[model samples]
Target: MKPSYPLMLTALFGLFALTGCGVVAPGLAAAPPTPVPKTHHSAAKQKPRTPSPVTVPRPTSGNELGVVPILEYHMIGPTEGRWQRTPQGLYQDLTWLYDHGFALVTMQQYESGDMNLPAGKHPAVLTFDDGDYSQFEWNSAHVPLPTSAVGVLEAFQKAHPDFPVTATFYLNNHPFGVDSVAKMQWLVAHGFELGNHTYTHADMSSLDASGIEKEIGEEQAYIEQSVPGYVPVSFALPYGGLPQDPTDRTAVLNGSYQGISWHFLGVALVGANPAPSPYSKTFSVSIPRIQVVDPSLVASSTRYYILSGYEAQFLQDPSMLYTSDGSPKWISFPQNLSAQLNPAYSSRANPEQ
Candidate 1:
């Protein structure tokens, strides 16, 4: 019933928003963000010069396209009760991420910026929404307990020490409790990062003006207290709606995340994001995220995502770069267009003579 970020994505009629051609994903939320106030740039006279062309990356090994495919998940347990995935399923997914060459990154790293195509490393983020009990359950439950989230990550990290890995979990207001905090501390010490999933996954769009403020203010306060040093800058729309954010500033104030986007980030059941264009296309609202579950899915998805391919060029200098909304391209690499001239245009009369 909720509209998703993909729904907000209206690519130049599919010229963009091309994740991978596969099965349709489930709905996370609905609606698009309302435009905010803007100020126009003053005009200034300047010398005339040739303008450079914008870039649409060609698909090739290394970085056919500049992007890193990140995967998002909810729960990992045997239940499959709500949005949960069994531990066995998680193991299958993680093992694939390892063998395939995805170097896991933490929120701290993301905050630092500079996401480049590290040599021989496929960078991808594994995020889990709603801090469910399943996280601690993986290794915590001894009687019939399976590998906890930490346990799985630990094993994966040990085996592939070369691949850097980390995960993000949005905790509710509920206390980490004495025991859970210790487990969480272990996760943080290892490499995991925690964030705020909005006090109780509260619906941002449905609330009134003042109501929206409270939702954010209250949740932020609780999240900060519940998880020490956990300052959330990103917010996942509860039920996936956009109408709430623009109407409210407090939300952004509390959630000042540098990268805020989401879309049909694939499902463990079926993957739709292919490499080369996985994270290449940009939509402010719904940035694409890959879903990691099946072993084959992980392997195939890795090949298709162009994280290690063109990211280097992009990082070196992002040409035609602009905000989420397509506007003026203020920066470029190699100082714009270079390559040889189209000589044919200069000598139309000669005609190859």
Candidate 2:
């Protein structure tokens, strides 16, 4: 059953008791709405572009087998409600995460085992799904609105340079309510990753094999065409619905549509829990994500409060959270957890005493 939006807001208000933690009262002022540009669906195809290689720093001291919080978000608007976070709330979320020794990493980085961070720092993946206009909007002057999600992230990074600006935006057709190819290019060029979220946000559980291919493939083709060589490597299941049939499910991991084949390294789910480290034996292509919603706003059956839930658990037992070993070449962890390391990464494992 879906949670009530109004009730969720009321619960958040009561949870924070109107604290100045960016939870504004209803009807708070926001930037005036700007005219949305028409999106382009160009049929022209171009060769796939490769992203520049990045250097991973030396390994720091921490458990590489710990869990990573792949935070999932939907709407970013003025009012905080079900599956929605306000601009202020978004800022506050980053503040809380930064203060808690968390740094931002892209979904690709997490999946490829390239997450290198400072000693004692942990990695967190910020994912925004169903790209709504509120998540990203450009003003008449061609600048991201201060209240937009991207704007908020840029601002936070500028203020806290140590907390790098990186995230994965899982987009559907007409992403962020705009079909402009330039917008898509802008995201990729700015170091943000664009992940496939299906073409129509279809419920895969009800769709057959062909339907799944079309949904996933069309979106991939669109992104690749839009960005001219940029292929999405990560996928987020729409509605968190996976194909019921085992074979159909496998198609999502690797499939082709109209000859435009795709291979996803990580498939994100809507589960409200931290994801296992990439180097863990338990790790697989299917990754779990914790919804960044307030626990009070959700029903008891759907408790996914980031602060009071998983974050609290990490605070209590830091070992449970994936702390970077600083170097990308070595997967380091306590010797006790040696058994948890995936054999594929055994050559790079550095189990310490």
Task: Show pairs that collide, candidate 2.
Answer: 39-179, 48-229, 49-229, 58-326, 58-327, 59-325, 59-326, 59-327, 60-325, 60-326
Q: Which ten residues in a row have the lowest lDDT in candidate 1?
A: 322-331
Best by lDDT: 2
Tell me the spans in candidate 1 whose CA falls farther than 4 Å from its real position: 1-65, 79-82, 107-112, 138-145, 175-178, 253-286, 292-353
TM-score to true structure, per model: 0.55, 0.82
* lDDT tens digits, residue span 203-319, model 2: 787898899999999999999989998999899877656677766776787799898999887878765567778888767777767777766677664453454577667778988
Output the TM-score of candidate 1: 0.55
Each candidate's lDDT (Cα)?
A: 0.42, 0.76
lDDT for 34 in candidate 2 is 18
User: Residue 138 of model 2: what lDDT?
Assistant: 84
Candidate 1 total steric clashes: 21
